[model samples]
Target chain A: MIIKRTKSHIAEIFCNVLCVFVITVVSVNAQKLNDDFFSPKSRLSFGNYLFLEKDYLRASNEYKEFLKTDNNDTVRFKLSESFLRIGRYEEAANNFKSLFFSTSLTDEARLGLFKSLFFEKNFVRFRQYRLEENYTTEKFSHDIDRLNYISYFFDSEPLPDSSRLFSAFADLNRADIKKFYYMKKNPDTKNPVTAALLSAAIPGLGKIYTGEIGDGITSLITTGLLVFLSANNFRHDHNFRGWLFAGFAALAYGGNIYGSAASAQIYNAGVKFNFDNEVKLFFEKHNYFLPEFDFVNR
Target chain B: MKKLFYKYFLLIEIFVVSSLFPQDRLSIQFDYANKLFQTSQYFDAITEYKRLLFFDEAKKYSYKAYFQIGKCYKAGAKFDEAIKYFSTASINAANENEKLSVYFEIVRTNISRRTTSRALQILDEIEKENTNTFIRDSINYWRGWTYIFADDWKNAADAFSKIKSDHELKKLCEQVEKEKVSVTFTKAISYFLPGAGEVYSGNILSGSITFGWNLLFGYLTINSFAEERIFDGMVIGSLGWLRFYRGNIQSAEESAKQKNIAIANKILKYLQYEYKGAKP
Candidate 1:
């Protein structure tokens, strides 16, 4: 009976061990079945991972490899996007142009091309492509129009009507846009001749009119003190002292006139600079109304 | 019975082999990632390290992978991302040595970002930890580097002095400190004598010009007053003499500061590319 019991125990142990071995082999096979390292699909997933990590160069290479076997629009767009992130605008534009005829991503690709042009500061070509009928998208018309108006602030293009120019901007930005438009249309320019005349009438008055109060005060004090000293010396019969002070007073007056005219020009330049900055910042804050790329979710 | 025992042994062997297979695969992937790192394929190495992290079921290589990812980001000059990964590595460190290494990397990244104060703060934190003498010495070494990068050669010298009297870096720092001009002293001398500070700061040409203007204008003002030409004296003294004197002081201070910056930058550039010593 004891022998029979021992034999049965040994058989049971053998069966249990066999079951464990079979489970291990099956699980290993299962894992292998799910992983296909060399396949294009896996490469695309890996590329996306790298792109998310901001490793654009490697991501672009991976997308390029995947493209050899696949002609997917999303991958193409991503490849161009990778180039765009790395500041290779020319290559990005070319890649995006290829997708401009794709059925599903044509609009996005066209917009991407415009963005590439804008980033490259080729505003003229951007405006030209924007007006092209082939590249127009009904859904994104407002964005394109906003970009059109914003371009005027950077370049020498004449601004359009306020209502039409700011129509595409959000309501919150209407006041700022209107202010910018008004500044562009009727700039607060100080006349250099007027500034010089004002300073001639009153030493440093022209600088004050040009918004340089500190310089105006200094000029007034310096010139006034010298002129007063000259008159007082002449009253005391000190001709040499009077003449010396008189000469310095004349120099101060001449310098004040020249400085006032230059100040007016500086004021006008500052006005232009501030206006340009405001318009650029407005568009930048709104991202030019462009749609955020939804590549990750897709 | 003997046949049954033989079958059982065979089955146990199969189970043991199968379980060891995944571990072996994990080690191979880890080595592959390391090889990529060694070749400077930082982006690809990052991907491989991530793969290793993903497949490592027991989390054995998790901290190591994170540390490597930090190093890759650092190589790419992405200091913010490098700090993020290094922080993760520190949190997952299994031993004090690993934690210390991650801390060192974080400090190095901060130094590259030019956030020297933040790097010093991290070093302070490392010093507070229960670390060995070797780690403490390393901390002081990097602290000296942080000060050097900030152009604070005096403080750098002091930090390196903690390592040893004859340390190479300490000597370099001391030499730089000795060669630097004192901006405050230059400005102070210029206050008493116009253009003197500029001359002391090695700008002799400018100093001579400033001195000549001050002297000419001073003579004119004094002569005008002696001749009872009050208006001429007032105008010349206030406008010409005072302006030159103030300008002399300002230029002297500026030149001294610039000279010190140039000296510091020369040493820093040498340390960055040519020095054969250990660096952060």
Candidate 2:
């Protein structure tokens, strides 16, 4: 009697285990087997993995696919941030712009849109953001204002009054900012007209003023030699040869004058390039003085 | 009989559950990614491959997924990114053949990116790693291709000749080597006698015209000096004779360089349009 009861109790437990096992197998078999691998959840998980890998181009593609089926602000922010990272600023701005109206990410997206425009060097559009979009976030307006002041240094936009531009930056950065301000205000420039006039008086004198000493000296020698040859041949009654030499001398002298003016223009271009490069480097090293957005990275 | 029936039920349940698992799902994903690849939807294919890599917890598909992603990148001509993924594939490679396959793609990428030095460097490392005769022949083949892209026909011919006594590419390289003009010879001959280098470089009319000008100036300059016209002689010598003489040497050297460039472009065109072998 005892053995038979024990056997029945053991059978009851085995039956229960088998019943649960059969239910699990049937339900699992009934569903699409690979749905878990390609479902929205897996996509988000995969997109996040690619996002963390800093493969922004691939990450953007994955995020775009994920966004097609889901409406998640964090993923949208990440997608826009990925575009920004890869220098696709237009797409980045458009994507960020989509987040502006009625979302918790409105402030970040607004800042991202402005950042895209600013980094694209579209200063005109960046400054006209409020007018163009009829949108502004009270939260990030001051940050945008800082970028607005910073943009003036990068482009040919007229600098605002010193007090206004200075007020946007912190006191700690005042010295460096003032240096850039002064550089933009009183940049050293050479006059092309003066270069031409100087070369007209003395062949190669303009080139010397433009810092091309070798070219200047070569011009002077060539012009002076032809002039001396013209004078000598004429004194010796070689009339045709003297006329030939004079014509050549006139051409060399005229070419030198024109070259001097062109050289001065080129010099001025170099000065502007260096100044622009310096400003670009400073801002790049300083992250353009924009506040760090660590939300998307998180 | 009831105990036997219970055992049978447990077996059926275990088999059903185990069969419906990640392995089957992962296999489907790999095949799906390959289908996308076959359709030339490279970017989508990469996404799918990455999808496989993401869910492959056992890492069974890691090497294949990474390799396919690298291939997609290579197809798009994004060599640097392709190289990064290929190196990653190499790291995940399960065996010698897989590693060689990854290395070949990397070297090929470097070649296409025109970083031939790096390509050769990797080939050299590969050679040192495996000295199997057949693999060495394959390495020599790529080395030949590397030299061909670099425009070093002599070395390319030498490398290919080592593979076969008369390989088609080796013959082409040799033909180019024989037909091309020599820069040093052109310059040296022009320095010794003006117009000769230009004539050798196939600039006939230019060579003759330059020769006539130099000869006329030469006579005039010597005559001026013979007549004791020192100033005239100095002017003619410095201005006319020296100008044409220097211009001859420079023009000849330029012609040689351009001829060599033409030969290189012809060979490259043949390779791009006509050759049957796999190209970097």
Q: What are the clashing pairs of model 2?
A: none
Candidate 2 docking band: acceptable
TM-score of each: 0.69, 0.84
Off by over 4 Å in 2: A1-20, A25-37, A130-134, A197-209, A212-257, B1-20, B36-41, B180-193, B222-230
lDDT of 2 by residue, A20-92 (tens): 7776776676564545766677777887888888979988877887899999998998999899989999999
Model 1 regions more than 4 Å off: A1-39, A50-58, A82-89, A115-123, A138-154, A161-183, A189-206, A217-262, A292-296, B1-62, B72-81, B109-116, B144-276
Q: Identify the candidate with maximal lDDT.
A: 2
- Clash count per candidate: 0, 0
True contacts kept of each: 0.05, 0.23
Could you tell me which 10 consecutive residues in candidate 2 chain B have the lowest summed lDDT?
A: B13-22
Tens digits of per-residue lDDT for model 2, B142-185: 99999988889999999999889899999999999999999999
Give lDDT: candidate 1, residue A15: 79
Which 10-residue window of candidate 1 chain B scores lowest in summed lDDT?
Answer: B11-20
Error of 2 at B273 (Å): 3.2
